[model samples]
Target: MYPPATRAAALALLRRGSSLNATSVALGVSRATLRGWVRNAGAYSPRVAARATCPRDRELDAGAYAHLLGLYLGDGCLSEHRKSVFALRIACDETYATLLDECVESMRAVMPNSVSRNPAPGCVHVTSYSKHWPCLFPQHGPGRKHERPIVLEPWQRESSSAIPSASSAACSTPTAAG
Candidate 1:
């Protein structure tokens, strides 16, 4: 099975008006495979279909949603280990235990089914078996998120705007105030 990230990238490329052949070449996937992915995108995740139908309706709180989006842009990625299970891995340096805790907290807030595990010394895996991961974190593209343009959907923008102050406060470094 193709990685959810790769499939997401293919969908992104196609959404930008790229031809099927071009998307296949850019993603290094077979034309038939790309076609199959396009056909199956909606069926792969019911949440994706629901989101497309109603963008304003969301399950995550504004603050946690914004935090999850930022985390996905920075260090998170989606991978499919099996035909039915997808894992969202966020790389975290071991020294930043607090950041890892925040990631776990945000993930739990967004997707309670997610479990945070330390796969390596400097990485944390917030893994789940949900097929909707790609739909939720669609920033996967040709290169690093920094190197590519990350555009938030209208609903995401509205949701993010709702909690900018909270997001900023949560993202700030803690200081010892005497």
Candidate 2:
């Protein structure tokens, strides 16, 4: 077990706006331990969650993210739960197992976590929950997407254009390996 002093130092560094990686490096603690400390202390706010899990805070795999973004804009929706957590749900046809796996892979590439596959009559709802979905996919992830003002950012346009149109996956990033 880590000492309480060490835990406090880690938390202090995190609260002072240090990235989890930076905090762990500076204090010689694992990122998992730091994340657990934050979880145990109930500091899962959006900002905290984003810093901890957002790909933007680290070396982002632009190609994977671009594919995921394309898939999301075309077929996914976001729902907000308590504690500011959001769920990104992509509807996939159950018959296409390869497509389902691809969706799950891209989601993990963007943010590492356990993604749930909810089966329906003919489709699977592939979902992963996080408090930073809106931050990563700010265009649409919460509420009725039709009600929201959707505008594609220039970078998103360029990224999507350079990619193989959402169905093809690409690249590797330093995932948390959950």
Candidate 3:
């Protein structure tokens, strides 16, 4: 184990505008270790890899997944963070409290992870952290979502099509408007 002095020195170099690669090379420490140190500076929280839950593994909640997908396709983005973790953020109007709650519910129903609502100036960012978000949402990419070509995977196509339509609903008695 390296001494605390070594860790402090490495962090000091990093604070002094040294890149992770350069700091590792100069301090004789591995980049992964440096990342771990940086990730857990104040407190050491072990990284617990989430379980593998995908369409292939089991049946996805079609209704909730479809709802989440719609919201995602509208104003959502998946950002990549350190250690291959991804944060899914969906923007909803701050005035719509039900929408923010629905967003959080859909995310939890889909991934059953920790979902948070971060309030912005005029909107709220409903975010969830997971490693499998990219796998679930194939449309995520760099730059604006509209700028990228959104071609769904075969599984996504099936999921979207699985959404129940209201065509089957038939009323025995017609209303005055009908």
Candidate 4:
């Protein structure tokens, strides 16, 4: 597996109009491999790296986020291990689980409101913070809920099916009926 940093470097070069064939030859990697790396890099890079800033600003929301974050920070002990998981993983398992739960819940509560509307239209800094903690924490970020279809009751389905087609439904509008 290619390291993220090296892959990022390769992607940067590729984005600068470098040919995949040339890059592969210079980097001593297959053209297809280089292309794959670039594709993966694009998957994680800021969604709007090339686009202008968003029209909706959130400077005013800073106070609200900070207040919630402060409350969250106050819940944990100051001396607790908050570094790499490998380091923390070596510590007590129970403690780690508790801290993980607290962190994930705190994040889930604060981020969706602080970040942006459903499916953020542009890159947001909250994504980076989320990367640090992901465990049953809805890693896809806000506005991106897992799409599981709701099981409908047979009667409910049949009742809905009895309704007329969309065109007829529209024609039943109060003004059209009058």
Best by lDDT: 2
Q: What would the per-residue lDDT of candidate 3 be over residues 19-121, giving only the tens digit for each residue?
A: 7778899999998897777666531223211232233355678877877887777767788855667888877877767767877887888876778888765
Residue 40 error, candidate 3, Å:
14
- The list of candidate 4 runs beyond 4 A from truth reads 43-178
Worst 10 residues of 1 by lDDT: 169-178
- Name the top TM-score candidate: 2
- Candidate 1 residue-wise lDDT, 96-170, digit = tens: 668777777877666545465656643445545455566666665445556567788887787678875433222
Instruction: Select the stronger candidate by TM-score from 1 and 3.
Output: 3
lDDT of candidate 2 over 50-145, digit per residue (tens): 445446556556777887886676667777656777778787777778878988988888777678999855677788887767777768533565
Query: For model 2, which pairs clash?
Result: 78-141
Give the backbone clash total of model 1: 0
TM-score of each: 0.54, 0.68, 0.62, 0.23
TM-score of 4: 0.23
Task: Rank all candidate structures by their TM-score, best first, as comma-separated numbers.
Answer: 2, 3, 1, 4
Report clash pairs, candidate 1. Answer: none
Q: Which model, 3 or 4, shows the larger TM-score?
A: 3
Cα RMSD, each candidate: 12.6, 8.0, 12.9, 20.9
Give a tens-digit lDDT track for model 4, residues 117-142: 12112211121132222221112222
- Residue 43 displacement (Å), model 4: 7.2
165 Cα displacement, candidate 1 (Å)? 6.3
Worst 10 residues of 3 by lDDT: 169-178
